[model samples]
Target: MTLNIVFMGTPDFAVPSLAELLSNGFNVVRVYTQPPRKSGRGQKLAKSPVHQFAELMGVPVETPESFRKPSVIDDLEALNVDVACVVAYGQILPQRALDAPKEGCLNLHGSLLPRWRGAAPIQRAIMSGDEKTGVQIIQMAKGLDTGDILLSETVPIQPTDTAGTLSERMSRTGAGLWPRALAALSRGGLTPTPQEGEPTYAHKIDKAEARLNWTRPAKTLDCHIRGLAPFPGAWCEMDGERLKIHLAEPSQGDGKPGEVLNDALLIACGDGALRLKTVQPAGKPKMSAEDFLRGTPVGKGTILT
Candidate 1:
């Protein structure tokens, strides 16, 4: 049927779905991505992954700051798209925009419906120590993530899974679901299921929340550390310098919270202890805890505040 699609997305998570749709022969008429922003030490303008990929695929792109303008809505209506696929587009789509597509807008959300329904879903799931989470494709509505679920797939949360790793898996899962969902929609075989369970909002991750509080249980601390890893990493002050903890595992041990039990970097917590595996000192590259100790030793019995 050569369904006409309008793809709206930004960031790395959205790239796979866009690529999948194109590869599967969906007629993507236009792509909407966030505008490039100043980034890095030099503050150079950086394009989003989706933007670069769309350009490489020879697809037309637009980066309007918002869709509130009447003209913008008019422009979208002019496209006459059959469906709009949105993934992490980074904006609250207005009702007019949602209604523009003939088959309604579909959102690829990175969480099980009715739970973690907001920004930072993946990080929130990991930080909360959830046993499992998944991706949901929902029919877009005016409210935030309060839409009818069209499709979903669950994935387990391993003890070692970080937000970065979990997101990669969820992205692939979403890419696979899109084709089947679109096919069902085409044949009128898809049923929209209302999201069940009490909803939990996933507020955006703030850098301030990444500070490690040694008073917390080892399990909680382990989850927090992994949830924010590879970006705004969970950190602690060691000798008045920030030491980011990238990898750690909970272990059996006991001491005053924040105390270093041994030379292996096994730190005491409110309950149990954590053996740090990877760490990064301020302004330094990530290194194994053993390697970090060789050059700059944190002696046993040293307290980490």
Candidate 2:
């Protein structure tokens, strides 16, 4: 029997799984994503990445403000889907919605279960300097990520990995897993196991946390910077203006924290230093440290606040 699927997700992270599912011949009857929100300086509305991709693929899409509404849940039940595959949906599911599909709702979560069991898993993992993290297919339960693990795969977190880079790799790995999970589901071969160990929450990142604190050790600062790069970037004040760091590496040096160590963009930390590799100045596109310094020279021995 062909399983009818209803896809629920809102971001780029979900698209690959949806694509993989469709490519492998899953009957995706509908897609549910967050509604379009205002974006950019123009303040024009922008549909989520999943919404756009679902449309391009000719799949029907629904954007409900909340599933708290009975009508919303009623509409979902109307789909009569055998399964609902959710990823980064950006909304909490009520128990009713979880029970709507014939089998149950399954979530494609970013972290190994019982750890990073909340909104900012990937960023939290990198920021914590974890050498390993992985993806999981879990049976959605009533509480926050307290679900049985259905499938999983471990992946190493390389030293060079930023939140952005790691996310892309994990998404692809998850894309491959979705097909296997669904196939196993069809054959009744999946074995669900209870999650073990104490859990850690990956709380949503606040903009206040993005400010660079040079008083922290160089290695910690490096992880912090990488964890928040490319979006809500780790930033610092220099020359009385804001500078966003996209990539930085720890190096040998010593000075008062935030002091400019040399002409090559090595800035001192409490314990060591870091070379500013990729950066973006206020109102400017991202550029290399060399390019930025060529256009705007920052002298050594100057202190950054």
Flag regions of model 2 displaced more than 4 Å: none
Which window of 10 residues has the lowest lDDT sum in candidate 2? 178-187
lDDT of 1 by residue, 125-225 (tens): 99999999998899999898999999999999999999889899889899888899898888888899999999999999997999999999999999999
List CA RMSD, all candidates.
0.8, 0.7
TM-scores for the candidates = 0.98, 0.99
Worst 10 residues of 1 by lDDT: 64-73
